[model samples]
Target chain A: MEPKMPRKERQIIATTITLLAVVFIYGYIIYKKYILENPELVYNLEFWGRKFFLMIPIMIGSLIILMIIFAIVNKILTNQDMETMTDEMDKLIELKALKISRWSTNICFLLAIGSQAIGKEPWVMMAVLVISCFAGAIVEAIAKIYYYKKGV
Target chain B: MGNCKIKNNIRTLRFMANEMTQQELAERTGVTRQTIVAIENGKYSPTLELAFRIAHIFNTPLQDVFSVDPDDLVLKKK
Candidate 1:
């Protein structure tokens, strides 16, 4: 038995894995290219601008592909039992996860202020903000999985 | 909620209803079998509407399917 995990829970777990993989892979590449190989790129806003601009498409594309893959497999396995709609427990779990993500974002903002006040470099602050967003996303996904496992 | 223990007789009721499996009951109640498992194991309490739905599925009274035995202080008031 596959344990009959709900489609919603499965989607949450899959999405979380995708986001984290992308973050780590993309983060490493960006760091090696800008911070290690070409240190001067960190000082240049154009480098950050172009890199993130490219990432927007890459991230969106990867997410869409992931969704399609999950849908295909889920439809095959669940057949008529495939449920894509939200239920009360799903909504509650989503809210619980969203609450944690929002709190993390607020903390990120506070840290952003502190970093600025302490005279950190503009690019360093930018990196912190980006990583914080990733952390928020990772936390949200983990919380959803946790609630799914423990019951909501 | 302050020592409020929500309990259900879903397992006993299912057995009486022709040895119904969790999947069968879940399909009838429009919930996942895991949710049925959670409810039976006392890990999660369903909402009032869902509770009523489950009772209806089993063709039993809501009071018969689920209950919350009041604490001593609350029971003393009865």
Candidate 2:
């Protein structure tokens, strides 16, 4: 394909990178708790569990805010492509991307469940779930770009 | 899976239309320039409705825009 690289694809890529950074930072922080100075933080299951519960809203809000910033950047990056509505081909690519992303997330969920069944730590479960969700978003963005450039 | 396909003269049509840019053609056809490029390069085949829309944007008949080989069909022509 000629591959013009649309604004939407750029936005998707920016968002994916941001999500990966966030996920990696979160993972590092969790890892620190387990290995760093007061190892008690890792054993504090209730605290991590509560923090994990609170993370849902925090992550959602952060992603929303980040996306808005990315959108503004995208507007500045492209001229008229953003003004146009998504055509049928674009929609089809989106559908395919979402399917692959969701499929990845579901597989990650199964892994989390299996870990929980094996009596793994709750913090590990939380980390895996949250990390994998972000990973799925990244996967979708990559897949979308691939299909757009290489054909569906 | 590659047994059948549609062919088009989008590049020729664009050339004839005063060297119309892909972006302009995409805007007229309500799709992204990337999609137009893909279609022109035979990397992607658009839906029937999209094909009609593209042909309409070029002010040409569907046959002039796209052609499917009868032999490629499950039911071949005599």
Candidate 3:
């Protein structure tokens, strides 16, 4: 197997995935409300199917652009040495961060379900989702800093 | 609460055994380089199966690879 990717590359990939997921969810909402309102605009199943398939290329292009930016930053920071992986301690800190993020995400999902059961508004649900994503990211960053400080 | 600090000499032994790199040792033991690094740094405690594998890779006893100190925990007599 290939060596583990550098932390910068991993971060770029993670960010790209998160960005694509958020964009796709928001785009789906718009498509359902605006585009689907006119059946004539729907054209055919194949046409909409093609658009769905097109997301792969769009995501790939976004990832490539992200990687290019990451590569440039990595080169500038490391003086062209990109082969170095993150240190062990840094990886542990990332693991802790991911753990916290996972927990936050799960809690947010449960809260969403709970709100839905209580007849919450759609806009409120959307707000909760957006805020939860940001909160999860913040929690992850905090967890990383905390673990680093604790020397774990 | 119990003292969770664990002590091992994997780093010292790795040095003695031709100064093997963490990556090389990790490969020999069929684990990720990060796992080896974590074990050496005491940031993560490996499971019993992994501990045995590490000990086997170093040609050392299992106790040489990992040990829990119970001195900090007060035990009740049965």
lDDT of each: 0.80, 0.78, 0.67
Top-lDDT candidate index: 1
Candidate 2 collision pairs: none
TM per candidate comes to 0.81, 0.78, 0.55
Instruction: Please give the fraction of native interface contacts (Cα pairs under 8 Å between A and B) kept by each candidate.
Output: 0.29, 0.71, 0.05
lDDT of 1: 0.80
Q: Who is ahead in DockQ, 2 or 3? A: 2
For model 1, which pairs clash? none
Q: Which candidate wins on DockQ?
A: 2
lDDT of 2 by residue, A71-152 (tens): 5765665533244477777898899999999999999998888889999987677767876787788888888899887886
User: What is residue A132's positional error in candidate 3, in angstroms?
Assistant: 1.6
Instruction: Give the DockQ (2 decimals) of all models.
Output: 0.37, 0.63, 0.14
C-alpha RMSD over true interface residues, each candidate: 2.4, 1.3, 6.2
Docking class of 1: acceptable
**What is the TM-score (0 to 1) of candidate 3?**
0.55
Determine which window of 10 residues in candidate 1 chain A has minimal summed lDDT: A78-87
Please, what's the RMSD in Å of model 1?
A: 3.7
